[model samples]
Target: MTRVCFELRIKPELLDEYVARHSPVWPEMLAEIAAAGRRNYSLFVAEGGRLIGYYETDDDTAAQAYLTASPIAARWEAEMSRFFVGLEARPDEAATPLTEIFHLADQLAAASTTSAEGDAL
Candidate 1:
């Protein structure tokens, strides 16, 4: 389960409309994502009109190829491009990968320890 995260700059005024459009994402688009092995997808908005999207995928290449080849996804991207910047050639534009430093989960009763003294201390 590889997790991916990226940011998109959205127009502040279009935030509401963007949320509304995504309230019930197109079934076909969801199907395409699932078909491509994408799971646990989510999006969030932060101050300064930054949109953060996250998802877990088994194969990034497959997921990306599926998205690029799916007509529904392509159309959706084009439609939503208006609400974002740097999306002029989107669907072709690649999403940047974020580095993962640490993760905490409720399933772990005891936290995993890490050496802080720089020598397995």
Candidate 2:
């Protein structure tokens, strides 16, 4: 599985609306994502309206092709551009990918288990 992560900025004032819309994401959009070989997708919001999106995919190229060919994705991007800045003016209307230095999920889980055991003693 390949892990992907990226950051994008959204207008603070539009956060509420954005969250509401995402509460029940379009079915077709979800289907498109799945068809693209993406899994365990998640998004996190940070200070200053920065949005961090992460996902694991078996085939990144296939996922990209699926997304680019999806009509639902295109429409969603157009609607979402209103709440984004750089994307609105960019040719692709998509966020740039970020480099990942470290991912320590297993190590963190082991540390948490160790801490719990110590607390019980």
Candidate 3:
């Protein structure tokens, strides 16, 4: 699975309402996300309304396409657009993924391979 992480900033004054809105995302929206092949999705908000989001998908492009074509997702994004800052496009479309620097599982798997090679040597 591809792990996707993205960052966006919310208007600090609207942070509370933003959080409240997500307390229970629309059921149709949630269903659409799962149908888009995104799993383990989560969002985090830091001080000053910095928002970080993460999710795993088997095919990021396909997932994005599915969500983009979904009417439910469109409605959700339209409502959420007001809480963001400096985004010219819909929030979902504007969520440029952050580059991944490290992952513990990958490093551990590499270490195991090296150790096994040494044992065979």
TM-score preference between candidates 2 and 3, better one? 3
Per-model TM-score, in order, reads 0.79, 0.78, 0.98
Superposed Cα deviation of residue 69, candidate 2 (Å): 0.7
Indicate the residue-level lDDT of 72 in model 2.
Answer: 83
What lDDT does each candidate get? 0.77, 0.80, 0.96
Model 2 backbone overlap count: 0
Candidate order by TM-score, decreasing, is 3, 1, 2
Higher-ranked by lDDT: 2 or 3: 3
| Model 2, C-alpha of 121: deviation from truth (Å) | 35
What lDDT tens digits, residue by residue, belong to model 3 across residues 3-117? 9999999999999999999989999999999999999999999999999999999999999999999999999999999999999999999976899999999999999999999
Clashes of 1: 0
Candidate 3, clashing residue pairs? Answer: none
Candidate 1 lDDT over residue span 17-100, tens digit each:
888998899888888888878899898998667888888988888888888888888898888888886565773254445687
- Residue range with the least summed lDDT across 10 consecutive positions in model 1: 106-115
Give the CA lDDT, 0 to 100, for residue 110 in model 3: 99
User: What is the overall TM-score of model 2 with all chains considered together?
Assistant: 0.78
Q: How many residue pairs clash per model?
A: 0, 0, 0
Which residues of candidate 2, in runs, are more than 4 Å off? 88-93, 105-121
